[model samples]
Target: MPPDSDSPLPTDAELQILRVLWSRGPSTVRDVLEALDGDQGYTTVLKHLQIMFDKGLATRDESGRAHVYAPATGEADTQRRLVEDLRDRAFGGSPETLVMRAISSEDVTEEELSKIRALLEEADGEKDDASSA
Candidate 1:
């Protein structure tokens, strides 16, 4: 499904599993576990998925022995909610401040810098049009 820019965001763990589901689509616990980067066990991934289902973060298709789990929410919605939450908690509810902080954050890479530049250029063009109108 396409990301919904306005949906509720999942928690960090929920986001992690959701990312896996979003990328792979309706994965079983074993599938998710194997995809995880660390030494996470199958049971552990299954446990997390169970918690996610209970939290209404995901849903399962029980057509077979291995249940296929997928996100019950939209990806874009999740990302928007997460970014907004971080803006409130970490940047005092200012997206401008959050963007500033993120750009200045140690984890930012050259690709991210290019993305920010592109977004800024897009915004600038929109503003120019609005002013001319």
Candidate 2:
């Protein structure tokens, strides 16, 4: 199921579990716990999955003996939501400021910079096309 737009964002622990689910596809609580290297206990991971299901961050398949869980939203969708939330709360809703801060804070690779430049050019092209229309 797709996540509800109104659903609360995943907490840090929940995000970790979601990443595992995203990478491994649907899995049981044991599977998730093992994938996490048992950093968190079985019950802890199970509880997180239960809460995630309630929050629309995950879906559970209870048809089988061990309930299999999967992420409710795609990775890209989750990332976009996270970035948008950060932009609104920390950057005064300015994506440029967010991007600038992120680039300055990290040692971005040259290839990454080239990708960013290409995206910017594509955005500019779209803007010009819109204006021409």
Q: What is the Cα-based TM-score of model 1?
A: 0.76
Q: Model 2, 13-69: lDDT tens per residue?
A: 999999999999999999999999969999999999999998889999999999999
The prediction achieving the highest lDDT against the true structure is 2
Error of 2 at 15 (Å): 0.8
Local distance difference test values of all predictions, in order: 0.81, 0.92
Per-residue lDDT tens digits for candidate 1, residues 1-133, read 3234443456667678898999999898888987887657778788888878776778888999889999887787677677777888998888889888779988999998999899999999999999999
Root-mean-square deviation of candidate 1 = 3.5
108 Cα displacement, candidate 2 (Å) = 1.4
- What shift in Å separates residue 79 of candidate 2 from its native position after superposition? 0.6
- List the candidates' TM-scores in order: 0.76, 0.93
Clashing pairs in 2: none
Candidate 1, poorest ten consecutive residues by summed lDDT: 1-10
